[model samples]
Target: MAKHSFEFKKKVVLEYLNGEGGTPYLSTKYGLGSNSQLRKWINAYKEFGDAGLMHSRKKECYSFDYKLHVVELYLTSEVSYQELAIQEGINNPALICNWVNRFQVAGLDALRSHKKGRRKTLDKTNSKDATQLTKDFTIDTSMEHVRELEDELLKLRIENAFLKELRRLRLEDEAKTRDLLGSSTVSEDNSN
Candidate 1:
């Protein structure tokens, strides 16, 4: 099963603390590993508030800032993913490339691991920029752009054809009117 986010964990912790349900009940409800894990979240939440609950117990050698720096290096420097992986002692070059691509497409938030116990590194500016980049990229690559352009061209072509046909009909009507007037004048002259 996929891991839950810190927000989800915090929510569960809050629910448990509110006396909304028992720990065993929560464990079963949320499909948690054990009752102890639920207890740990409650204790952490009580001790450090929401932030404490979001903190991961696992030791991280790399900080969020460090990961951002690494991603910037890869993007700005055009460094190969394999070289970056080797330099960072990362086993998977493909993972590094994915991180770089995601950063380009989605910004700094994409570099974060989606593990449940991991705290999300939330930076307002970075998050906004990432979101904007994602929006822009999505707009550019979407089929909607092509469809809109096609629709406009079609409308323009239809209008042009309509105008041409209207002009032709108007000219034909004028010619018939002139012919009718000319024949009537000739007949009147003969009658006179």
Candidate 2:
């Protein structure tokens, strides 16, 4: 359903609550799905008052800093996406990717979610890891150490890429196997 402004929702909800009109009338008038939705608004208003109806213009989109931080974690740190998601209290890593892409293309404005919610906190563990990874590994005296770390990181990247490829191949193989088995079973049944 299309979103209505908070002001419009509040007006309908208040009218319903004050018995200026019944739920059905308000629902029809406001083009809401059902009386239940109208009731939810009324209940929300009653419980939280005007504060509950207030909407954040920012819409929970990721700030530019947040997007930069996520990219840093993925690129520099050894943290997995799942681990990062858990640390950031995000339910989906794809959302993070979306934020990253948005930041890359549209800059800061793209990171915003268009909903209001609590902000993600910085992962102290990841921050510490990033610090340690970059620390004292200069271009001159630490070249050897840098090379060693780079080799290890390269190995990890290869392993991660291989694992992803393996998973894709395995899924394809499974699908083909299932198809063959199903066809064989069908042939047997037809012959019988």
Candidate 3:
């Protein structure tokens, strides 16, 4: 179903309350889904005033069970994200999508909260053993490192050769210009 604005919901609820017409007639006239939708809005308006008609703008924390339940519901049913959000009292549909994605990737364990920050870098000193940091730091002579260094050296060599060629060309151009100037000066002297 299409999302209705706060003003539209308020107008409909007020219209119903003001005896403009019953839920069925007003809902049809306004092209709303059904009387049930109108009734929901009216109930919300009665309970929370204008705020009830508006979409919630808060970041609500969900329990692991709740997240699992929602994901399972989504997987089992053909419910859209908006409908799920409405049912779960979640403001953001994207949050549900993310939960489903996480559940798919790592199952229920992924629903657990993770510590925020950059991950710690692996200890490079323990090349010989399993993450054991030793005082004697050894240089990495791995084939992967060797290949990476070789690739970088090859790029530098190519850049150096190109620069040398450019310098040679510039020097040649300068020499030609100097020779032309000399010849021109000699000719002018002869003409004098």
> Which candidate's lDDT is highest?
3
Worst 10 residues of 1 by lDDT: 52-61
Can you tell me which runs of candidate 2 are displaced by over 4 Å? 58-192
RMSD of each: 26.3, 13.4, 22.5
Error of 1 at 133 (Å): 54
In order of lDDT, best first, we have 3, 1, 2
Against the true structure, candidate 1 reaches a TM-score of 0.28
Instruction: Please give me the total number of clashing residue pairs in predicted model 1.
Output: 0
Scored by TM-score, the top model is 3
Per-model lDDT: 0.69, 0.66, 0.75
Residue 129, model 1, lDDT: 90
Candidate scoring better on lDDT of 1 and 2: 1
Model 3 vs. true fold: TM: 0.38
User: Compared with the true structure, what per-residue lDDT tens digits does model 2 show for residues 1-192?
Assistant: 338778898889878767889999888877887887676556556655775455544445556456656765664456766557656755445667665566556644354446569987656657777776567445455787775586457446645765776788899999999999999999999999
TM-score of model 2 vs. true structure: 0.30
Q: Which lDDT tens digits does candidate 1 get at residues 37-140? A: 77756755665566544545554456655676666556545467756765675544566676667766765456556667878675566777989988988988
Error of 2 at 175 (Å): 50
Candidate 3, superposed: residue stretches over 4 Å from native: 65-192
TM-score of each predicted structure versus truth: 0.28, 0.30, 0.38
lDDT of 1: 0.69
